[model samples]
Target: MELRQYLHAHGKDSIGIIGVSWAEDRFGDPSESRLQRIAAFIDPKIPVVRETDDLVKAFSPLEQVPANFVYNRSGKLIYGDGSPKLMTKKQLEGLLAGSK
Candidate 1:
């Protein structure tokens, strides 16, 4: 099963997922209207957070996009990799099992 489906079926209450996007202001800062339009385009099912600046630097001095992180119940990062791939269902299940 895919990560999204597995989360919904098994870990919906125990896990949370959020997607983040950086504000790439190369040419110029996009107007509020443009930003709103972009936000509207995102899927409502996925919770997304937008960062105007590099907030990852505060956690770790690494400038990597498409980072994946999994935090335990205590809000401690248990898994972090600068890759777009998500944890497999088995891997997530193992973590959940260990927590209890």
Candidate 2:
């Protein structure tokens, strides 16, 4: 499952991983059928958020693709980078634990 691979099998209780898709930027708004098709391949426990105005507050200054954002359990942005696979689950768990 992409969810398992993305989080290295961690991420539960106070942690989770979600995929954000910007396909609408070029392909146009997502239809129910289109979202359903994409969801078919993903684990039902994981969510893929389609781009929308609702995202402006959290991801307004969007820069580049394949980006990574790590937010703490409090919904605070803790780490961000222009690259993917920046931090391991163990590292994140330790960091977040100390933050509390």
Candidate 3:
């Protein structure tokens, strides 16, 4: 999903973006660059990260799976599921807006 819309829906809230290569093919590296651009353009304060123990971390080789996972500040698992549903930009926005 596009970062700006997601941030707008969250409205000052923070969210992580973890990419699972095997989970979804909708997001590719080239498109990720676009998403990054959107992030920079809109929600620069949200913070985007890759491979960190923070809010977000993109992983590859999903089948080589690890038991570990990252959680949100609320202690919710943000990754490590088998084939997560691909979140479209609008879907993400809706979810974030509705999240408590």
Candidate 4:
């Protein structure tokens, strides 16, 4: 949720959140819950694409655009690990600030 706020604060209308399905086994549902929290915290009207369980198993979104790395208009990686990194609210804020 915080990440969405940070991105909005920086004038971005959309930002992506990526997670591996395996994360559920390691981190539990709180991770997905957190995304929901962030959506509620930021813009309830915004869209969130959650890829998990049958959603991911049936559709491989990551196979097209992995996670973590930020892509510029030209398709260049700007920040983040080339894959998603579990981040805290503060870390997400810092990253959003850097993107600005």
At residue 76, what lDDT does model 2 achieve? 82
Please give, for residues 1-100, the per-residue lDDT of candidate 1 as tens digits. 3556565667555566666655344336746566555444432355656664456563453345445577777887777755555567787777767766
Query: How do the residues 1-100 of candidate 4 rate in per-residue lDDT, one tens digit apiece?
Result: 4455566665555465443333344454447676666556656655666445786554333333224455554555566543445455576556555766
Pull out the clashing pairs in model 1.
Answer: none
Candidate 1 vs candidate 3, lDDT winner: 1
Among the numbered candidates, top lDDT falls to: 2
lDDT of 4 at 97: 57
lDDT of 2 by residue, 1-100 (tens): 3334544455443556686775546556657666656555544565787777777456656555546677776888887744454565566666767777
lDDT score of residue 21 within candidate 2? 72
Clashing pairs in 4: 1-38
Residue-level lDDT of model 3, residues 12-61, one tens digit each, is: 45666443223223344445666566556765554544443332233333
lDDT of 2 at 91: 69
TM-score of 3: 0.36
> Candidate 3, clashing residue pairs?
none
TM-score for each of the candidates: 0.58, 0.53, 0.36, 0.39
Candidate models: Cα lDDT each: 0.58, 0.61, 0.47, 0.52
Model 1, runs deviating above 4 Å: 23-45, 59-66
Q: Tell me how far the alpha carbon of residue 55 in candidate 3 is from the true structure, in angstroms, after superposition.
A: 11
